[model samples]
Target: WLLFLGITLFQIPRIASQFKEENWHRISETIPVSEGTMLLTLDTQAEDPDFNEVSLKIEGTADSLVTLEKEFFSRGKTKAESLENAKVLGYQVSVLDSLVSFPPGFDYSAMDVFRDQKVNLILKVPYEKPFLMDRSLLDILRNTIYRNGYKSRDVREKNIWAFNEAGLVCLTCGSTTDETENQDPNEDQTEEEQINREKLDSLSRAKFRQRLDSIE
Candidate 1:
């Protein structure tokens, strides 16, 4: 009996180290607006390489101008202890007239255990009102936009949009009209373009040489 007890005690810490718990954290806010469009921006940044995923869902609702729901999952040694630790990492939502912003809630860089975490944001806005989104969020939802026969070069710095019965669309292209107008749609390359390309290549080589020199 004494030998068995000693073995069990030795295994207790090993078993406990593998224990994991998932915690859910959420925030909801309502913005008041009578008429006009609202702009929603999502700012997400994670320093930890283990930070796995961040998912966002935006839908239209007649009930509110802006509503945000965030879920956080945290894993640790015990369920109760994990949840208590997660509560320390809080987020904030801000509203200013017709604009709503969401910034990274917790300072994960300051804490070590908070490295393994995932955040999901769900935003609901008025259906009829027009809104603009930041490029960061748009990049995450790019799969939802249709891309058939569209080359990466064609849309690299251009605005992307979708049109259908639902009338969902991307607001504007990244490039300005003057920039687009200056380019020739013809297949033949211009002399000025050739010169500019060569200059860029030379600059790139110089930068590469500097990096290698620094390493040596």
Candidate 2:
């Protein structure tokens, strides 16, 4: 019994290290675009821990609704475990009356195999034409944009720029460099700045409240 326990403890670290290196796959597809404004939707049915990062590129003249560049990450003990779990998941893309939807599909009864697994997706779409998105995608982007310090009155006003030759552009809360540099050191902060600071503060407070509530 002592030897068995010792060998199990020795293999624990190796098993953990293998899971730490996540497995992923990438696929790109271009679908034909119908006339009028495009609608993008990301629908998921699994209750697993999934994170999606979606962005847009606005320079291109092609014959498609949008180009979907997708990368799927698997969080499992082994590559084969992740890949097999991912196979059970599904992605559906359809266009109806200028509305393009990407909804998640899978058999709910078969989701028992999804324990401790996650699916992280990175979707890139063309932004040359006008498009609308579902609330799920909007919420994800809103949290990311807000965390990056861009306080837009509406999500529609927010735009993702193309990556420049110098690499990724620095994200700001819609503050210009000149304005940041020209601010008077001794002058009081503006109301907008104060509000932004408060908003950030509230996020931490909200998390603390949740923890307290859980304990109660």
Candidate 3:
């Protein structure tokens, strides 16, 4: 006797279309994430955490990558297999060049083995209201690689994701960049002039506040 099992895989186009519809609000806004949006929550107290004192974890894995650090001209990179043991706001990241040694029994010629597989970076930031700026961090990483004359697809890949409380997860890829162009000629003023202006503004504000406090 022979038995046959029917299998159906979800359609990618449908999934993508549904996602766009669901996130239309975010996609339409010039600045979807507000300035005060919580990017990461640094809790100093958590029991039996991987880092023991602090742990860094993201809400999703879409922002995870395995990439080379040198290719990015980045100085911050460290090896990490689990966010459970990472420090919150940690700068030590993992790079691809350093991960040449895979675990034993793992075949490098596997079908899903992305040639640039090692050039991936995974960052787990705490869940915050704004998680990050309006733009994703992956864009920034890609731009940096491109600016350095390195083909992003050939070099390393960077992923920045966020995680929130209640064990919810979300992932994203690429970095973000400000699209705003300065219209004010003063925008390019000398650093000294800008510093002086800021100092004067602070002094004036301080005087006004002091006068108001006295009346109260």
Candidate 4:
């Protein structure tokens, strides 16, 4: 390695130009959306740091297909060489049934040299489709607006949200970012609660008077 480094120093200008990043390749794929699925969960955990960085974006689409897009970059003497180098793909997507276990980043450990390879996942779905975002997706979800003025990360993980024309919206009470429109837990009364309230109110006159006298 040292000998190669020393040899390259003799022709720094020519060698450096040979390794300049000059080309990028793009790819896009679409998949059909499954039926009867309402909830989508994102895996919060990230993959190994050594791998190339991958970014994710999700949006509501009138169309029923989910799209995955990627851009791979490489340094080469010619455009064809760069294209051929970037053609080596190694990432995988895991979207089975309801539970999502996909890795959060792209894997590039097997590849030689550093190629500015990037992957962008575009999950398209109908409006009002519910989802649970992991805290890790904050970087990708910031652009998305939620019902009211709540930030995407501000909503709790347990809370479910609907991705609609309006953006990310809280579907449940606990998931709301603000106190507005919050209903009181005691506002609704059941038969047992009514009976309990009546019992407390209908104290005997003598006992009520005695209690009042004691307080006085």
Best by TM-score: 4
* TM-score per model over all chains: 0.50, 0.45, 0.19, 0.59
lDDT (Cα, tens digit) per residue for candidate 4, span 1-216: 999998888789776665665576777766443543333444556554444655566667665555556666666667776676677745566666654444656666665665455555556655544556656555444245442345554545566554444344455534344554532223355667645533432332234345447779
Q: After superposing candidate 4, which stretches have Cα over 4 Å from the reference? A: 1-15, 18-21, 31-47, 139-152, 173-216
Candidate 1: C-alpha RMSD to true structure equals: 16.0
lDDT of each: 0.50, 0.44, 0.26, 0.54
Model 4 scores what on Cα lDDT? Answer: 0.54
**How do the residues 86-195 of candidate 2 rate in per-residue lDDT, one tens digit apiece?**
55544446657666555442222444443343333344433234455444555334233233333333233232221122112222213323332211221254677655
By summed lDDT, the worst window of 10 consecutive residues in model 4 runs over 197-206
Name the TM-score of candidate 3.
0.19
Candidates sorted by TM-score, descending order?
4, 1, 2, 3
Best lDDT among the predictions, by candidate number = 4
The reply for model 3, stretches above 4 Å from the true place, is 1-8, 21-189
Q: State the TM-score for model 1.
A: 0.50
Off by over 4 Å in 1: 1-19, 32-34, 42-54, 109-112, 139-216
